[model samples]
Target: MDSIDLEVLHACDQWLRAGWRCEYVTVVRTWGSSPRPEGATMAIRADGVVVGSVSGGCIEDDLIAAVRENGIVRTAPEVITYGISADEAHRFGLPCGGTIQLVVEPLGAHSRMDELLALAQRRVLTRRTLDLTTGAVELAQGQADEQLRMDGQALVTIHGPRLRMLIIGAGQLSQFLAQIAVGLEYQVTVCDPREEYRASWSLPGVEVVHAMPDDLVLEMKLDSRSAVIALTHDPKLDDLALMEALKTDAFYVGAIGSRANNARRRERLREFDLTEDQIAKLHGPIGLYIGSKTPYEIAVSILAELTAVKNGVALPAQMSVEHGKALAA
Candidate 1:
């Protein structure tokens, strides 16, 4: 599935190609408890059709009403702010008197949206800079760590996957996990050397490779924005990847197993060249303990913990499988 931002871009491209006036709106800044974070986008056609969101509903409603009445009359990009006052905050439905700043750009040939869409579809990280004084846009290669920035002259936005996930197995659990990860806008790759498993693995938008997990881990050169998950439950396959993954800067490295198996796995990792902190980075027993039994439920549980870690949310010990189960016992 395409991300909301990508979908907005696609809609803008289609609208422009169809000879319809459209405007691309982006949330550049937010204050207090805003509904959406910076970089959230929406595309509005002259007929008041929209494909994405900037706030809960009130903001979109106002934008749509304006477009329907004024018919996208703007010829150049303009910045607008909402919810700056207490009454305005309540009117826009911004919680806690939140304020949001947006740049609404009139889409045309000079927008370079088609090129941005093409690059985004190919999963190429791109930085799109839009001149505030003029409608001209420039596209360049962007790093994974780049964030959206706006100054007096231009607004720069980063597109494509900013996070990646490497699953060390192509099993049923991995299939579910990979699907969810893709929907979360993560570039997901599954590596398994076993022919029997890899032969049947087929998922669109996810790259599957027939290589040893450990070798693939080394090849990826995982960074802090990357995650590694081992669901094969085979020590030979999972352990090999875990050892290499733990040594990298991957923010999350987890394996699926029981408490006893995870303990044994940790003990085994001590024999490797990994440091104590690196070994401690491994998240075994894989997921938050939500009493998940089926593969789909387990996948949800795993993603919950992964998301928490990614967002820097420190989940309580009782939320883990090992700790929760032990408390129950």
Candidate 2:
């Protein structure tokens, strides 16, 4: 399913097109294990209708009620917080007594949402800085270093680009990986030079590139939020592009092969002048050790490991392989 923020952003764009006054309410910060992350958002209408959510259903319902009852619906742009105490948590469905801050800004023709949409479309890393004092918004170049100022007032927020992935092959495994990646909001691109594989490839919502893998990686300028996975297992095709991707800041670069083949791939990369650390980042035997036998099962394993590394989590040596199959059996 599309994320709440993405859905709200889509609704906001539609509202703008229809010329209705709308406000974008974003969850800027959370004190504890909140329902959503820092960039969570909801779009509210003048009539108190809301789409998307910053918390569980209760908090969204309260926000909707606030629009209908509170006078701020007609007054100005502002920020609000909820679930600060045990009572408030009970009322808002926050499991652990926590709080979440939201930034509610009335939408306008000059809200810079077009830029945000454009950045999201291209999967470019864009950072938006909101000046609470002046209520001004600034779009930065990228998302590496961001500063938020919540000091005393309501909230200061930043929205970073969604992580992206580029799979160098359009095989069955790539199809499975692409589908899962899209659900996770990764803009997926599949590259394949082999006509045999590219011709039979068919998957919705994934970009199919017929260019040479190395050229595609270079042209795309794989950035830090990007990931490159080689699924073809063909050295001539996969290794050429891997050499180029390793030089870039792509967060995760991996290939599918056996443990012995992984060793060989490392030796080849080292010969290409990739430093020890750079070559070490390449995750081969790509998936966690789930004993995956089928292409789909293997894809799940690879994506699980990818997610772990992406979130800066240390995954166990054994992969999560029991997703399918009869657990009772």
Clashing pairs in 2: none
lDDT of 1 by residue, 134-192 (tens): 98999999986789999999999998755889998888999999989998988899998
After superposition, candidate 1 runs with Cα above 4 Å error = 17-19, 85-91, 121-124, 138-146, 191-211, 218-223, 270-277, 291-294, 316-318
After best superposition, candidate 1 residue 284: deviation in angstroms? 1.4
- For model 2 the local lDDT of residue 164 reads 70
Q: What C-alpha RMSD separates each model from the true structure?
A: 3.3, 4.3
Measured with C-alpha atoms, the lDDT of residue 70 in candidate 1 is 81
Please, what are the lDDT tens digits per residue for candidate 2 over residues 1-329? 34455567677887887887778887777888788877778888767778877887888888778777763343345777888888988889887768888878877666677777777666655666665554566776765656455654334445555677999998888998898888887888999988888898767778898899999999988887899999988998899899999999998999987666877988888888778888878888787666678878888889888888887898654442322222323
Q: List the residue pairs that clash in candidate 1.
A: none
Predicted candidate 1, C-alpha RMSD: 3.3
- What overall lDDT, based on C-alpha atoms, would model 2 receive against the true structure? 0.77
Weakest ten-residue segment in model 2 by summed lDDT: 320-329
Over all chains combined, what TM-score does candidate 2 have?
0.85
